[model samples]
Target: MGTASSQLDPEVTEKVSRDVNDLISKHRVVIFAKNICPYCHMAKNVFIEMNEAYHWVDLSKRPDGREMQYFLADLTGQSTVPRVFVNGKCIGGGQETQELYKKGILQNLLNQS
Candidate 1:
């Protein structure tokens, strides 16, 4: 997988990079994933259930999203869907996100943000 910065068009890439940066800068949690992905769905569901506010980027819809897919692959070395980020840090995929949730660390991060 390529980094989000690598897969985007000059314009879209700039936009997404800014978007991700702004999200990390303004919000506590951000999730980047495809709508059809089950793990992505689960991650969203968890956030919804907890009533936590998060920014979700649906890479399947946007032209720049393909770039994000590559970015995810490059960073994680896995082709898994639903790559998440917290506080400007890559937090891995759905299972890892869930593990953080299970460990009660997700809430802590959210709260801290």
Candidate 2:
């Protein structure tokens, strides 16, 4: 399978592809989310508590949200929202983010190479 992009109009898919790439490249943290997703909210809370700002892509509000989520599934190996990334790497979702927080690894990951 190529990616979720294949499901979209090729033009939109291409643009979202570029947007996703730009986001992961330029942001320290990124979350692919829907507006009402609790997990996505929880994930954002973790970063906020850290006093970190992240790129929050509210897919529900975007025309390309679904396609982007599909692309993210390919990138992170997960289809769920609240897909979190740090330092240009997929760290995971709500529970995973919390686990890392509880272990004190989240801080380390924030700044590590």
Candidate 3:
């Protein structure tokens, strides 16, 4: 069965896709998140502790938030907040990000760029 995002208008979906891609391309690290989500906070804290700067979109605060989340689900195969990208690649979400941080892999990913 098709997902809800698949039911979205093609034009809107395309625009959101392009806009998101542009954001990802423009930042070395990007977190697509919702403000109240603790998982999102955890992910953000990882970068903060590393003293690395990142760009993050608070999906809950945007008019297009729901569409963005749907787009993320389509792109990453998961529908969760704190969808993180390093160097324009999906590195999974909060707990996954925390795992990478624990293993010291996240830092390495950051340093590569």
Candidate 4:
């Protein structure tokens, strides 16, 4: 699944693409992260400390995770772990997420939703 698949089924591609899109679009606050990433913990903690709820997908547990990572890069212009989204909009990685929280923008988004 990592390379060109001459015999790949179209249905499979469609389903995987839809799965990726759904994972990103279905949540108010989406954090695509790896379980062991420190930045991932930091991002999640920000939400926790603020008493905010967020949806998180640990890509390390998915078979199509790398594909989703690439998909995210194309869709959001960044591919790194902890791709944080607020209200279906890409807010970026750990540093960016924390920074937004510090500047009070993240709180506004949370309230808006």
Ranking by lDDT: 3, 2, 4, 1
Index of the highest-TM-score prediction: 3
The lDDT for every candidate, in the order shown, is 0.75, 0.87, 0.92, 0.80
Q: Flag regions of model 2 displaced more than 4 Å.
A: 1-3
**TM-score per candidate, in order?**
0.75, 0.89, 0.96, 0.84
For residues 1-113, write the lDDT of model 2, one tens digit per residue: 56665766888777877999899989989988898999999999998898988899999998778888888887778899888989888889988998999899999998785
Model 4 accuracy (lDDT, Cα): 0.80
Considering lDDT, which of the candidate structures 1 and 4 is the better prediction for this target?
A: 4
lDDT of 1 by residue, 6-99 (tens): 6456776666556656765676677888999999988887788788777888889977677666655665677677877777777778888888
RMSD of 3: 0.9
Give the per-residue lDDT digits (tens) of candidate 3, residues 59-97.
Answer: 989888899899999999999898999998999999999
Error of 4 at 81 (Å): 0.6
Residue clash pairs of candidate 3: none
**Best to worst by TM-score, what's the order?**
3, 2, 4, 1
